[model samples]
Target chain A: MPERGLLIVLSGPSGVGKGTVRKAIFESPDNDFEYSVSMTTRQKRPGEVEGVDYYYRTREEFEALIAEGKMLEYAEYVGNYYGTPLDYVNQTLDEGKDVFLEIEVQGAKKVKEQVPDGVFIFLTPPDLTELKSRIVGRGTDQLDVIEKRMEIAKKEIEMMTLYDYAVVNDSVPLAVEKIKQIIKSEHLRVDRVIDSYLKMLKEL
Target chain B: MPERGLLIVLSGPSGVGKGTVRKAIFESPDNDFEYSVSMTTRQKRPGEVEGVDYYYRTREEFEALIAEGKMLEYAEYVGNYYGTPLDYVNQTLDEGKDVFLEIEVQGAKKVKEQVPDGVFIFLTPPDLTELKSRIVGRGTDQLDVIEKRMEIAKKEIEMMTLYDYAVVNDSVPLAVEKIKQIIKSEHLRVDRVIDSYLKMLKEL
Candidate 1:
């Protein structure tokens, strides 16, 4: 039997380019991990698929999943509920595909508490200056906007202590390469290795 | 300041081509790891440098290191002493180079007790059939040799649980790729990441 896939939670502060790194890593069809599609109450925007982008659910349908304790971690933003569906993650892992959850630091810790097997990774910027540049690169010069982001970045950086790994987003390609290596190496972890070898050799 | 290097203990059963895998990974100059030059009382063979191949030492000097508790792991085979020096490993790591110690499973456990921070990796063969083929591939048909080696392989395979990671040596190049990935991923471990970012960001 094939080994079950890893549950990976990739998180970072804003302006760390988490989405860009994710897109780059998954750009190739050969990548084996499964990107988690979140369940949301928000209406679908243009060019969004039903299940591919988000599992859209009505208020009752979403509440039913919460009552069933299937939501790994959920929060309401702007009167819309959004959460990770635990069953989908388990199903994907059962299919032998590593699951990737792109989340904020707080959600990462919350998901980690629920699924301790998840590998929590923090993507850090090279420095505060680089982070500020990336934040402003999104197109803005407002003083308060940059200051507020810098403040949030400080708190999120401290949350890295709870993570299992930290990779600097020095270059998008390099960061993606490091993440790929991490996922590959994690498959070689002793506990994660299949017991078939032991069983086969022990009979000798 | 640069990050401190990892101390890696790579062990495997006989006929697993551990040495071949090691050489392939370190063949590239870009690899930052250092191979440990062992101290031994054995006579230097041709093409072996004093410190490069082995730190040639007299029997009395080798005993002194053993008595001083300076040898990380040592064994007296054929009236010749062979052992790893703790000081050399520390000096290389202090110079920001990862140290690789290719030893047996027993020596790995012994060294791990002294340096608990060391990363232990076990290399397993593809299967017992592959192992037997590799052993026979060495052009030895002696029943006693094959039987003795098979017995030892079974024992060492059982000890794999003591390792942090296990890579299957299905092919030399692929095994080397897996080992390289393991080393690269290890550097991203949370505890090893420097707090420079934290201190710098908090001052904002």
Candidate 2:
């Protein structure tokens, strides 16, 4: 039987480019992981395809999944719910295909509770100064609002201690390369591959 | 001060091509690690250099170092003493230059006792059947001797569980690539890198 696939969780504080790095990983022709499409109550944007961009759901539908614990982890923002579908993630992994989750820090924390074995990668800005600049570069918030955002970012950065790998997002390509290295290395970990060797030993 | 560099221990069963793979790594133009030159009482070959190759030593001197607990790990083979020097490995690591030790499985186990944090990699033959064939193909051992070698190889393969990563030596370049990934990934592991991130967070 094929070995079970890794559950790769990519997350970071706001504006750390988690989405961009995740996109680069998918755009690479050689990437084999199945991106876990999230279910959301938010309106689908133009050209978005169902089951591709997201599994759009109504308020009641999302709440029902939560009630049934079908959502692996969910959080509401602006009166809309977003979460990972537990069944799809499990099915993909059972098929020996890795599942990649790109989510916010809060959602990542919740995912950790249920899937503690998942490879949690916390992507960070090069430093807090850079992170602040990225936030300010948005050019969309007031001084007080930016300070509030920085405060929230600080709290999320502190949560990095809970992660298994912390990658500096110094550059998109470099970050993607490091993450790929991490995934490949994780596959070779003794605990993951020893059982196959043990079975081979028995045959020998 | 810079973080201490990793002590990379690469070992596997006899005939698994550990030496060939280790040579490939060092031969690579971008390889940055300092190879830990082992001290040996065996006569140096015609073209061998003193420090570049083995640190040729007399049997008496080798025994004195061992008695003083100055050898990191050593073993006597074919009436010749061979071992890694403890001082060189420690001093190189303290200087933040990674030290690579390519040794036999028995030597690897002893090094593990002294440096438990070292990244131990086990290189394996594709399978025991293939391993047996490699032994038989050597064309030098008698049938009974071949069987005895196979027995020793089996025992060494069993020691793979003590390693952190195991790469099957199906091909040299692929195994080398996997080992490189393992090293880069090791550098990124949370336990290895969290302190800098914590200090950065404190400053923020």
Candidate 3:
């Protein structure tokens, strides 16, 4: 039988270094997992190609897909739609390719509702103080905006109970190692590997 | 806050290298996990310690624990009572140490019922032929006994669906590495870690 791939959902509070960890995991040869390209209504940034970073879509197109229930989970932020494409993820998994979805708290929840077996990983800062420092260091948001983000982070942390595991992003290398370990361990799940062997044994 | 250790259940067919994998995991200094010493009525073999390999118990004591609902799960096999001690497993978990229970198929299901959050791992042989070879290679069992063990292995493989993860023990090192990964990934579960952080943030 062909090996199966795992659907892993990576989420965290803002400024927990999820992006950096993800990059490290991808860069390491240890991770042959595929990344799920998201569908978004946001305009492509500089040097971002269609279907590479995201499947950039018009609002109407995004809405049409939503109405058709084609999207696994989607949300509107700043008047733009951002969500996962069910077909892409399912296809990758069917090909025995582990797929990683980097999304926010709400998106992760929605994906879980749709795919309960999907591995949910929450990245955390070492401590609250470190989280605040990371947010401040970003220097992109005003004090009030950062405060609001911190508030949101607190709310996201409360939802950690819903996830399958948590990794503290104390160091990017360590966090990436943890993420890789989760993916490796998930593949060992018995339900995915045993039935076929059992059937073969029965035939014998 | 100190990190909490996970409760891991390792179950698989006999001669599938479950013991070997467990040994490797325990031998690793980086693994920092504890094995749950089971309680049983079986006579201790040579070199076996009462509290280390197992808590040797009389049939009456085993029955008493069962009647008192202290045993997580108990069963009679060849006139011996074998079961997991609830207090020991709980105490180890509470101490922030991950507990590994190397159990049979039946005991694994019972443990899962008692601790739904516990991670269940099922080790499997690469194939039936290899399974038979391994059992025979042990040089301890008679032909009839080996045959009976294979029959039991077949039955256990059918119940694979009850497990959380299945790992094929084709290679000892590979299997151990996969298990190590699972333990690491489980630590990253979002709901468990993030929610606690979020709760602490709210209180702050």
The digit string of per-residue lDDT tens for model 1 on A26-79 reads 895668898998899999999999998899999899999999999988889899
Task: Please state the error at residue B166 of candidate 2 in Å.
Answer: 1.0
Worst 10 residues of 2 chain B by lDDT: B195-204
* lDDT digits (tens) for residues B1-204 of candidate 1: 445688998888766787787778779667778999889999999999988889999999989989999999988888998889989998888887899998876788899889887888999877643554644556657878877767766676678878989888888888878888898898888877646556555444
Q: A97-171 in candidate 2: lDDT tens per residue?
A: 899999998899999989888899989777653564555767777888877867776676677877888898988
Scanning candidate 1 chain B in windows of ten residues, the lowest lDDT window is B128-137
lDDT of each: 0.82, 0.87, 0.79
Give RMSD (Å) of candidate 1 vs. truth: 4.9
- In model 3, which regions exceed 4 Å deviation? A1-4, A40-46, A56-64, A75-83, A129-153, A194-204, B1-5, B40-46, B57-67, B76-83, B128-154, B191-204
**Candidate 2 error regions (>4 Å):** A128-157, A200-204, B128-157, B199-204
TM-score of each: 0.86, 0.86, 0.77
What does DockQ give for each predicted structure?
Answer: 0.47, 0.44, 0.45
Global lDDT of model 2: 0.87
User: Worst 10-residue stretch by lDDT in candidate 3 chain B?
Assistant: B191-200
